[model samples]
Target: MTGFFTVCTMEEEGADPVIAAFYRAALEPGQWHAALRAFARLAGGDVACCFLKAEAGLAPSRAHICGLDEQAWEDGYRRYYHAIDPGYTVLKQGMPGRMYLMQDYISARAVARSEYFQDFYLRAGVRYSCSGTIRDGGGLTILSAHRAAGQGRYDGRTRLQLQRVLEHLPNVFRLRDTAQQAQVHGALAWAALDELPRAILLVDACLQLVFMNQAAQRLLCGPPLAPSLASATAAIVLRGGKVGVRATAVQQRLAQRVRQVCAG
Candidate 1:
């Protein structure tokens, strides 16, 4: 997935400042925790998480916890509650991008009696949760928000607010996937270029060398910017003294050859 699905409820240009901040956090790498926290705050929850479940029966491939102690999350959710979670089956079978309330499937009475509630939710102070799925190429992803005990179940307004975020999450994942794929493809192309026999150097618009072929290294390698190649065909864009013993005339011919090779 390259980008998250963006819910159409708010436009970036004229949206509330908080929503704008949330969008920035959601799109940035390693900023999901902040984004989730922003979501929880807006949706009336205390804790939020975004996780990937690669396959049925397997632990989540990845999870980002927002507004929860790491230990509490590990002990209460990752280590145990997930297996017995009442919402798992429902969310698993639910529509990919639709929001679903956890309380609807498991009543408070049922939660009070369940092992997950007694050992996990109660200990962590969470009494209710809501979740929505975001599609991923590798597996299923779920975004969950939790409210503490005494906070009461999520209300209709909260659900509507969460749905706005949910509707666009899938697109976010798609954008991320597309970016990653483009990066991988670019790396492969660079590797192919590196395999060419002639020395090659790639310089950016700033004239700073960003990449050099192995042949280039052998030809001119005291340091970057210190070209030491003896070939005149090669553009010896150097910043140091010449060490090669080749005749100047021969070096010029080789430099020309280098130029031709690079052009080809």
Candidate 2:
């Protein structure tokens, strides 16, 4: 389990209650605002920023920010900081175990105080920023935390705490998705089959492993399975009077059956 994350062991006079309150709020859904503000106050900076890598040419559309409004977000996109933003482009190269801090940007202070970033920060009330990558073999997820004026810039200790949050964010999401998927699967018997121990694989007509369970996840991705590593999502099984191509065979069989009935 992750440790309790705080900037320092010793707290300023009368600061504990305030920080503890934010700590409690962070646990509640839709209460990130308290935590974000707490981080800024703790860091002695002003802003808290968050980032998620997005599809190309859709920076404005997909950027995730905490303090700013749509106009600054749109302005950042229209102005092309999405491209110039070192955190976005640089952090993509980072692996989970590794992390980075922007200690020496030629335009670091300048850009932070620039007409552009400042407007976004001032309007949004953010003073500091921290970003980290969260990815499993399943896919990629990145989160950036932000702050505004007097919300101090991140220090080494703060960075480590933020990194801990980065790692946990994915698991947090998995739990959320599992809950949501459970609600959906409960309504459909076919999908509810996923709860079973059997290795059930759902493939499109194309024979891809669109979904699989722990049993299948282990088998198909293990040494025993003969799926091609090059395939996007795949598994091996017998179907249609033959072995290995269950998805493809299932599609072909269904098509043949459909054709026969149509002819009749």
Candidate 3:
């Protein structure tokens, strides 16, 4: 509410740079928190958050949050809202960028007339809310913010600011996903993938480094820095006191046995 701290408006030239910063930062290894914090700061809201659903059959996860200090923000912040909140179920009827009051939504959902209104949001000082969704080829993501009713709900200007930035939110989530996959894959490459007593060598019978567990890497310099999935099923040295055939063959056999066991 202070004049010195003006929330950036969508129509303002300053908004574009902020938008680009978040878009690029979302792709970085550990910069998501900063990007969301900046967004919440610029929005002057009590909470600004991003949610993403990993797969079609899986529930969504709370991947990012800013300006809230509560116990386990992830649950109430992600799956719980969609699973139980009537306001969100009805938000689908509204236009993408248009701002609407939470009361308008709850009223439409008959929440205003329901037994759950007071205990739900009012006692917690969360009254007004605005939300929007963006989708990529595979799935959709939601961005939302909430504020006390006395603070006023998001106006058209606020909605426009958010809508403009969130136009790129899907791409942010994509890059974030890519970064996470890279990190997990990187860890797996170094992890002792199974309880194999033999130090494995991830190599292609045709001559390529595919993947090596930590035990395997401790034996050699490490499977090549790059492991190609195509080269995973061939015979390679099973070094480091490991008495199995080349890694590729052993892994293939192990996988085949596991499949056979499952089948049986």
TM-score of each: 0.60, 0.47, 0.51
Worst 10 residues of 3 by lDDT: 1-10
Off by over 4 Å in 1: 1-23, 182-264
TM match of model 2 to true structure: 0.47
Q: Write the per-residue lDDT of candidate 2 for residues 27-142, one digit (tens) a residue.
A: 33354566555544444454454444443434433233444565666665445666665555556666653345544331567766565455544455653456666654343455
Error of 2 at 119 (Å): 7.6
Name the candidate that leads on lDDT: 1
Tens digits of lDDT, candidate 3, 9-106? 22334345456556446545355666666666556556666665443435566456665654445444343444555555655566543434565556
Which candidate's TM-score is highest? Answer: 1
Candidate 3 accuracy as lDDT: 0.51
How far residue 56's Cα lies from its native spot in candidate 1, in Å, is 1.8
**Model 3, residue pairs in steric clash:** 236-246
Query: Could you give candidate 1's per-residue lDDT for residues 1-264 as a string of tens digits?
Result: 111111122223322323434444533566777778777887676788888876566777578888788877776677767887778888877888888988788876887689888877777777788898877766888888889868877887788778777765654555444445657576643454355443445543332355666766665664443333233323354333321223576446544543453454
Model 1: residue 69 alpha-carbon error in angstroms? 1.7
